[model samples]
Target chain A: MNTKAFEKLNYTLSLLSAANGDKHHGCIINSLHQVTASYPAKFTVTVNKDHETYQAIKASGSFSVTLLAADCPEGLIDCFGYRSGRVKDKFAEYAVKTDGMGNPYLMEHMVARISCKVVDSLDIGSYMLLVGEVTESEVLGDGPVLTLQEFTNRGKTTPPAATVYRTMAGNGFRCTVCGYIYEGESLPADYVCPICRAPASKFVKQD
Target chain B: MNTKAFEKLNYTLSLLSAANGDKHHGCIINSLHQVTASYPAKFTVTVNKDHETYQAIKASGSFSVTLLAADCPEGLIDCFGYRSGRVKDKFAEYAVKTDGMGNPYLMEHMVARISCKVVDSLDIGSYMLLVGEVTESEVLGDGPVLTLQEFTNRGKTTPPAATVYRTMAGNGFRCTVCGYIYEGESLPADYVCPICRAPASKFVKQD
Candidate 1:
């Protein structure tokens, strides 16, 4: 696989966030696009079906997209992206505000916050494509949005796992959703990932 | 409407190109994403239903995505993005090469080129969602990919009109796909947009 070639396809990364009452969930997403030019502006967001943010948006029919800036703190990604909403309240750890519609958007290190209402959705095998119309939008900061290339160049390899962070921890399983390494003698049936809260079914044995 | 907010959501843009035999088409698309992690890698690209590239991909069941670089020539965008395949052969004007499958991939200032075969599709009102599995991917150059913010800051406003080049002609109808302004008497019913090759029906009168 031409892994480096794939990295060259730089894309703007964002935090797809949604809230169902006090339950706020957010996840890092690389696939999003503006579908129309204002006048009930539309946008499309694609997410892995197993992701907690996907479940939150599906239940609420509303979500907020916070465009992460180049200067965004690493802690923000660790809290909202590395940790799952099912086990942790990401908003509690960060300074954020809820819109009138109840979606919590990050207040720090973000360039803009756009609120949306889902008008339609499509199911692809492992992901769901949500089509939504922008209800409200606001500029939060003047910093440039972060691109995948910049993120990679900054030595921040997020997702499935950061190759540099692990030290071959003795044939353990890694969480596919949050990249949490679990070291154990045998896979337990009732075990759930501590970092992303994904079930045992979502863990893949380390090579 | 917070117009400036949209600018904050800077995304990397690319030209989606496809060919069936000698019949080729390419169009500008901002919405594309990797659906799965490698191994018969999957991707989804959303394109307007009216776009010629959409018909070409639907017919050929294959396509190529070229990640335009920061230094990509303006003529490339003007030719592929601004013009349609129905009016003329865009590939004829540029120096391009074909892959093993005979798909035309731009050899110019592109960061990477990915070839895919369409696996599934969905209708999303104004656009079609094409799901394709990556067959091949190669890095064309080490140049940085172009993002929407950089393109805007470079003063390259792609459509409706180029903000820097135009003299603001009075009461002109602009091609919706490409920003070519027709400055003349009542638009002829048979008039086709020279820039984008869109019909008179696709023109929207300037405000």
Candidate 2:
């Protein structure tokens, strides 16, 4: 089998977000598809079982999908795709809004957002295919949907954006492994870096 | 919900083909997605239950996916998409080949073809989501993958291709509703137009 052929297939990129109680997480995925066009439409999103967002969906029983636009900033992709949500609050820096289902969705650089309730799920070993029945959907912008191929092409021509750390006032613990900052009076004894999964021992107090 | 927004999201066009014993059928779909990137890759295809191709896959336990290329002729799409395979043999004019799993796949204007064995299926009202494990795949061409949006755009500019009926010397039946031609010594009493679901009485003998 020529696995490289799979690379040639184009897929639109989407941000799959879910919230379990107050814990919210989101990740970039390219496997969202509308399965049926009937009234109360259905869609499916393929997510790795290891993702924090997947766990949130499994617990919350719902998810919000935001189709990324062609004009989406590179920093947004890097923030969601390259880092682990477990070590950092992925939505803290963005203007996040809850859908009708109370699932979080980003408000910027998105073509559309759909709220879905889990109707069924199939476990495909490492990945879980979640079938979502559309509860509410809205067109956010008129920009073209971003494809994975176009995102890669853009990365080749544009220089990587510099990582911007949030300005901290007094007490801030930064993970040495992934530079994920935790703001508080002091780091908890059982604290772990959500992005890198590093223990408190790997964190240093920001000067 | 603004349903018009759904039309803006892009999807790559694919031909999902399956064979049950000697019965073969194929249909155009846009919901094929690679679910996992594991060693034995997994993909999901959503098919309408009303499609003859879906019944073929349900009985065969396997299917072949041909990702259409940008250069694909419009006639091919109209034949496989606009017509039903139950009344007409959609593959009669095309060069078809069986994959390792005995599922039929088209040989022209395709970027890649993948044969997959059904591992699991989920029925969602009018649609069935079939999960397949990749058994065999090959990259057929380097042409760009065709998106549904591109196909619609092409249709707007290019005039519709003329319908060319197959020439027959012996007894042949033509469907009045959909112009489907069936070449046989005599039309069966129970024969129905596969394309339009018209009854045998609706067929007229060709001169």
Model 1, residue B204: what's the lDDT?
66
Q: Top model by DockQ, which number? A: 1
lDDT, candidate 1, B71-129, per-residue tens: 98788777776676778788887777876667787878888888888888876555667
The CAPRI category of model 1 is acceptable
User: After TM-score superposition, what is the CA distance of residue B158 in candidate 1 from its true location, in Å?
Assistant: 2.5
Q: Could you tell me the lDDT of residue A187 within candidate 1? A: 78
Identify the leading candidate in terms of TM-score. Answer: 1
Model 2 residue A49 CA deviation (Å) reads 1.5
For residues B1-207, write the lDDT of model 2, one tens digit per residue: 766656667878888899978978887778777877444678888776767788889888999999999988889888776677767798899888999878889878999988899999998765678898888888998888988778777653211111111234678886644456789869999997766687899777876
lDDT of 1 by residue, A14-74 (tens): 8888886568888777666676542356777777677778788888998998888888778
What residue pairs are clashing in model 2? Answer: A86-A194, A87-A193, A87-A194, A87-A195, B86-B194, B87-B193, B87-B194
